[model samples]
Target: MPEHSDLGLLVLPEAVCLAEALCDLDWRRYVAMVELNFDLTQFYDHVAHRLGQPRMFARSIAWNRDGDPLRRWVMAHCGRHKQTRNQYWDRVRRHQLPLVHSGR
Candidate 1:
């Protein structure tokens, strides 16, 4: 069969699984851990899709699983500075996204 070189394709689980595999490859490496930063934002950059909600579940926690356990992925220096996730959560709280809503 002839191949259509003009056609393009994209997939999610493959990219996700590949990123996760990279994490597995270098679980202890700083680059593989926190600095890798695999999330919806990065996904959009890679796969060009709009993932609306539940990024936590959508994104595999490979980074956090392998990242520095002693740190909170945020600044631990007496609240001196904030992390990117902190800023995102603050924006979410300001907008009432309710990512952690309890079943009532």
Candidate 2:
């Protein structure tokens, strides 16, 4: 898998897995995942819950996408520095959107 700057979290295996997973996906699939908040959010939520950490997931997305709109949305709404699983839960709390598995 290609090395992406976003997945560069020291001692975080989830980051590696996320990086590999995303890198392996086609661009359209990636966009769908983000837009639907399906597989991508699940991956992020699992990592955050397991690690008991916040911000890293958003940080990774932010670092990776830069000018990408999905990155911007993630950083703005999901990375507020105030909650756990902000990316996933924030949408859940505010939008009432539950996690939907896309058979990934």
Candidate 3:
């Protein structure tokens, strides 16, 4: 969530959330990812710096246009990721305060 504002940026790549997989999968494949600091103060800072509360998680594309996804399954997983993200958004809408925005 953005600090002192309701507006927040949800930057999904191909419209998918990327946090839940933070600890589950190896991120070697996702070269196009913009991750902020992986600490406490930095976490609050990321949220505070935003224009408003982050109602949804977003991923700024860290991959270059030339970065190739080696497998078709990778692309397919991204699609599923998008669907999962939309569900997350719906859950957030049901609440008031923002949840912890998981880190890199």
Candidate 4:
């Protein structure tokens, strides 16, 4: 991951919401949107429109580095990690297994 000097640009709560919304999109739609947008500005505009936040723009909440905290959070919370974690919890519940947090 690349370092970011402007780590504070994105608001955590808003970025989390955006990540969740992205995760909720069907794979095809996600791909289509990515294909259509030429840049992050256009992408953000489409996302903001979908999210009904017309005022939201890339400038207000942008990630300038590969190691942006928002990017890390989205990766951990929105994709394969989320799917696997959900599957694990579902199986645990089905088996009536007790959950033990290791406090990572």
Per-candidate local distance difference test: 0.40, 0.51, 0.38, 0.51
lDDT of 3: 0.38
Better of 1 and 2 by lDDT: 2
Residue pairs whose backbone atoms clash in candidate 4: none
The TM-score that candidate 1 achieves is 0.20
| Candidate 4: stretches off by over 4 Å | 1-16, 27-37, 46-56, 60-63, 70-104
Clashing pairs in 1: none
Give the winner by TM-score: 1 or 3. 3
- lDDT, candidate 4, 21-104, per-residue tens: 567656324433332123335545555665667644443434445555533443444353445556765776779966688989
Q: Can you rank all candidates by lDDT, best first?
A: 2, 4, 1, 3
Tens-digit per-residue lDDT, 1-104, candidate 2: 66677766466675675455445445334444354444455545444555556856645654575565545544454344334444555666677757689999
lDDT: the better of candidates 3 and 4: 4
On lDDT, who's better, 1 or 3? 1
lDDT preference between candidates 2 and 3, better one: 2
Q: What's the lDDT for residue 75 in model 2?
A: 43
- Point out the worst 10-residue segment of candidate 1 by lDDT: 69-78
TM-score for every candidate vs. truth? 0.20, 0.23, 0.27, 0.27
Task: After the best TM-score superposition of candidate 2, give how far the Cα of residue 4 lies from its true spot, in angstroms.
Answer: 26
